[model samples]
Target chain A: MNAHHLRRGALFLWTALLLAFIFAPIVSTIIFSFNADRFPSLPWAGFSVRWYEAVFADATILRGLINSLIVAGATAIVASFLGFAAAYVDYRYRFLGKVVYTALIALPPAVPVVILGIAMLTFEGRLGLSGTLTGVAVGHIVLAVPFAMALVRMRLADLDPDIERAAWNLGATPWAAVSGVVIPFCLPAILASIFLTAAVSFDEFMIAWFVSGVNETLPVRVLAMLQGQVSPKINAIGAIVFVVSMSLVVIAQVLIGNRADRSSKRT
Target chain B: MAFWAIPPILWQFAFFVVPLGFLVAMTFWSVRSFRLTPDMTLANWMFILKAGFFRSAYIYTFKLALLTALIASLSAFPAAYTLAFRLQPRTRRFLIFMLVVPFFTSYPVRIYSTQIFFSPEGIINAMIAPLGLGPVSVLDTPTGTVVGYLVLTLPLVLLLQTFALMNTPRDLIEAAHNLGCGRFRTILTVIVPTARVGLVLAATFAFVLSFGDYVAPLYLGGSNPPTLSILIADQVKSGNNWPRASVVAVTMILTLIVVMTAMLALAYGGRKKGRG
Candidate 1:
């Protein structure tokens, strides 16, 4: 008993140390974003929110945020639509070459971001879509689709097949069956995936580097700032972006969990 | 069913397959006065093959990947093991959530944070200066880049290995203990062996992530030999040489395939040895 107690204490201590190592950078960044000093460093310099004011006042940064919104919004819509369609097909009907479809959909996230970025840029250039916000959207769609598909498939696979079949037997057409039964069944997962894809597209930088032309996304703008100087302003903007996206992810998870609970009760 | 697969197939083929094929083909083509000409030649491939700079960059990238994988897996083991075996389920879930939270920060932002932390006039230097210790230069060096890589990869390693360790059977460890094995011996012979496949998969993921990253090396790897990813990015962003960039991309892709195969073999091998 004593040995077990000693072992548990050591494990807890080690875990605490590792957790601290992981949080150090993030906690420092969030703290120093309010640093009164010009440089983002320690010594407990007096706190100020002046850097947040700077971020809000910057027009170029705001434009980049708008550009990011456009790309991420389009990505969320297109990726979720295509991903749900693919996942629905795989789940509802048995078919040949389904595994190939699964592999093709999941493979993009595995490919190197730089390679994917350049490839899309070249391909978009071929279609005369290069150097436009639309081109960036094109890359974002590809980048985000895999995640959307995986999420949709997971949700779709969990649904009871009898509900959809019952709808079909009640004189509903295939499309009608899906609209009535399947769409409602997978709505929460679809919504969650849309938000998740938006977060991913918003965070992406490499694809934006290669595919985007005149307009910079928020991350690209941050990269440009990084080239000249390291200031409290970078920390401020980074903290805001991090907080906003993390909240989106957490909120999406909460919403999805609630829907899942209600559905389980109904079932 | 066929109809369902068609749209996604067409979508992916148009956006992904065609572009990848185009990229590979471009490697064999030549450029004339900034224009891509479909003149098939081995000139670009030959150039990358012969360039000592590219050769060293490839080796250096592999080195970083290996080192990152080793460091992350070693450090992650205790944390993952603790979470899988020692903690209550609720506490374990909360800790896992906390580990994943940092990843929500943008990739470039996370890498950029390290820049401020390790600068010559930054926090580390300041702390050491007060102690009368000489200033340590970590920013822009390989060490800095490694630290950035660990910041991202370590948590991932922890999560992956925890899943693997949780899947391990508790009975095996108990059986070893019953067989008169000491605590350390049981852990060595039973627990570590059983966790090998999961551990290898976790390491493989870390290796691949660190290997292909361009943003980290571009921002954190100052004055270091440009990684293959940086070389690939430079070829297009600055050099306007798509074909040359494709050559590097092709090499990187091939390396990825080779590394994946090697890791999968190790996973299978580890499982067999553990069973034996």
Candidate 2:
């Protein structure tokens, strides 16, 4: 082959291998979830719905899932409300300590979650709120707020100020202008942020590990299970979680992408 | 607007900022058999400095963090390059989407899956069984820990790199190619130089994520003494050494700040150069 043809062939081969490496473990887990064998490894003992049936039968995994859903739902609601407010002020007012506020919001994700967990442990101890679901929710709020804020802030930056100005000029109050006009305009961004926040809170481990007392979230339960022993059932659990999380993220991406495209077209 | 801002500000202050300040303060307080005292002391910081075990833990953790960042970024580059430039636009989007799917899954679940793949009776051993490569012990080894890091951070690096690469002007690449440059030569000369900022940012993200990670090592790094994160946890939970934990916490925060600042400066410099 000529050099150009040879180069193209090499690129194709490399891309295929890269894709395989990325997807192998994922595909393997999915395959094992269907395997009838007790071991997670190969030589599939024929396909069966036994593991999925077993997962549903297990009270612990089901409870963990429900706990995660509640925490993630609560976190999304509280974080998005607070984040929207914070982003609005920062975007419009240019208040004192804006830089500091921005930095603090960004800091949690950057700091080690373990350290944050310990910090929360100490802080909650003083408040006598340690080892409570409230404490875990508080921790989730702290972590999820920054992500929510960043997402909303990006949307706010894209919005035209004239729309709000026009509402004000028409004798609308500031709250009326914002609530009636601005929020509706940024609805897609807000929705995306909620989904993203929920995913993050649901998946969070370290912070939940420290703060969760008698209440175990799905990830915390999974960690406990893995540490105690290797169970093929964990693979079944992992496969279900992977599919659910991936679907949520895909939905979030599609929403955000669609909004961007529409906005660009409008402009 | 002011009314709305008030509640979030108050909530954040109470829950976020105040907690961090309290943690710093708690470090100095005395702990006697798990009960904290109001009396302050410098003994905890001193203990961290003098204790050989903690000192070694800090060194080992730092080394692992550095190696994980370096290795993840290197492996990520090739895949990123392929997605960014080599693939058709439709195919590129599909690949990028596929890469990010892994990240949406729970972090602990991902680590648990990695354990299954690398454990003695796992798939890797199953694949090698016929070759007499009996039961390779991948989990619990430093190498295994690094593999876990790679599995966790690879998607992140890829996503960041793809974002960076998307911003590079197509015309610039075309210009270089028109000048008789080979594809690889064009990538090195035109693409790499332009995309270096993204690479650095991706590396920073990888470093910060891997360094701060406690979960992967906790599950996979069996028998390895606590990483710096685990050490910090130990002090707080088991040892009741809050002050020393504070010192370690402060050290880690400072290290991250330095690295993040350097990455930002590099990105800023690149943007300024591009504009010029």
Specify the poorest-scoring 10-residue window by lDDT in model 2 chain B: B267-276
Fraction of true contacts retained by every candidate, in order, equals 0.66, 0.60
- The sequence of per-residue lDDT tens digits that candidate 1 reaches over residues A1-267 is 999789878878987888777887788778889989887766777989999999889998889889998988999999988888888877877767778877887788778888888888777888988788888888888878888888888888778899888888898998888888888888888998888888888888888988887788988888888777776778887898888788768866876787778869988
lDDT of 2 by residue, B1-276 (tens): 568677677777788788888777766777787667876787777777788987887777778877988987777766777788777899888877788787677677667777888877778888889999777786787777777777778888878887787878999989988889987788777787788888888888888887778877777887386677877777766777776787788778778889889888876666766756
The i-RMS of every model, in angstroms, reads 1.6, 2.0
Clashing pairs in 1: none
TM-score of chain B of each: 0.93, 0.90
| Predicted candidate 1 versus true structure: per-residue lDDT over B1-276, tens digit per residue | 555667776788888888999999999999998899997899999999999999999899889989999999988888898999888999998888888777678767777777877788777788789899968887778887788778878888999899888988988877888888987787677777778788899999899888888877777887387888899888898998999899999898889889989989888865555666
DockQ per candidate: 0.67, 0.62
> Which stretch of 10 consecutive residues in model 1 chain B shows the poorest summed lDDT?
B267-276
